[model samples]
Target: MPAPRKYPDELPERAVREVRTTSRPIAHVAKDLGIHKEALRGWVRQAEADAGERDDRLTAAEHEELKQLREEAAELRRANEILKAASAPFAQELDRPRTRPTRRSTA
Candidate 1:
């Protein structure tokens, strides 16, 4: 006859609280809890992935905004350069000495 299948044991209350509070490795706690390492690892990984994805989405949005801002700054710089190039000749003309015409005296 086949041996009766053993059910998994419930984890200790204190250990459960510790796992919740400290964010320690579930595999380590699982050892004390007398559960399979793979099962605990699966739960931990799923929870971690879910939490990480939430923060990742926010980071991605910030990155896209930064990229757009950088492009706008670069475009403004290019416009400023063009304006400077266009104004250089006028600036030089203003800097040159002005010649005055002598007035002729009428008798």
Candidate 2:
């Protein structure tokens, strides 16, 4: 369900390494690779996360799990709402006793 990536993972890996090993600016590196500077910056951040250099972002698996959890939570909330709606009219009758209907005279 994920969108197609504009650039391949290998390309970013190579680009990040190029930026780190070379003294070139990130914009310069991204320009050389024909990628957007912001995209390249995201790749660098991701690389750092993968390397455990950054602690704020989640790892790929953790991020995936979180996405799945959020989706499941949304679905459960929807189901709860549906159940509530279906039982709305009946809920008020819980304490009432059943009664027989009065017969009507036929003409």
Candidate 3:
């Protein structure tokens, strides 16, 4: 699980908007908003990625999809392990030789 956010949900958007519209330095904006400058800078970068302004980082939607795909891959691997474990006994049985009973002559 993700750690709880230190700032409110709206703060990032507000800070990014402030920086974009006012052209103020990130440190100054962060100081005015009581936010960490690095965090605000990261938010601005993410916002730019979301807006298609940057290509170096994944967009928010792509990030979410990648997270979901990773979870799905993990789940599939777990299921495959369980299936292999469950089939092991049957596989061993199949590998063993079976003997035919000899017919008895009538006396």
Candidate 4:
């Protein structure tokens, strides 16, 4: 299982909002808050994305959906592989012609 979120969604939003309102450099605020500068940078980017600032990153819901779709695709592929493996011997048997049994002679 993955670790629980270190920072909740609202916290990041609040942090970004504070930085935006105060016009303070992220590094300084992040230092004050004891958070990594890069983590704050990511929060800012996510905030921008939510506000339609960047097109490069997916929104949280879109990101979750993409992850689920990828997992479903991988599961379907595994099922197909398993079906192929399970049917291989049966397929080989089907390919052979059936022979009639010989009749025994009665004296």
Strongest candidate by TM-score = 3
Candidate 4, which segments miss by more than 4 Å at Cα? 8-10, 98-107
Better structure of 1 and 4 per lDDT? 4
TM-score for all models, in order of appearance: 0.44, 0.74, 0.92, 0.79
lDDT digits (tens) for residues 1-107 of candidate 3: 89998999999999999999999999999999998999999999999999999999999999999999999999999999999999999999999999999999998
Model 1, 1-107: lDDT tens per residue? 64753533344335555676887887788787777767666445444444574442334346579988999999999999999999999999999999999999998
What lDDT tens digits, residue by residue, belong to model 2 across residues 5-94? 888869988999998899699999999899999999988888788789999988777888999999999999999999999998898788
The C-alpha local distance difference test score for the whole of candidate 1 amounts to 0.67
Instruction: Indicate whether candidate 3 or candidate 4 has the larger TM-score.
Output: 3
- List pairs with backbone clashes in candidate 4: none
The better candidate by lDDT, 1 or 2, is: 2
All candidates' lDDT scores?
0.67, 0.90, 0.98, 0.88
lDDT of 4 by residue, 2-98 (tens): 7888877587777888788999999998888777889999988877877888999887777889999999999999999999999999999999999
Better of 3 and 4 by lDDT: 3
Which residue pairs collide, candidate 1?
Answer: none
Error of 3 at 66 (Å): 0.7
TM-score (C-alpha) between model 1 and the true structure: 0.44
Score residue 76 of candidate 2 by CA lDDT: 100
Clashes of each: 0, 0, 0, 0
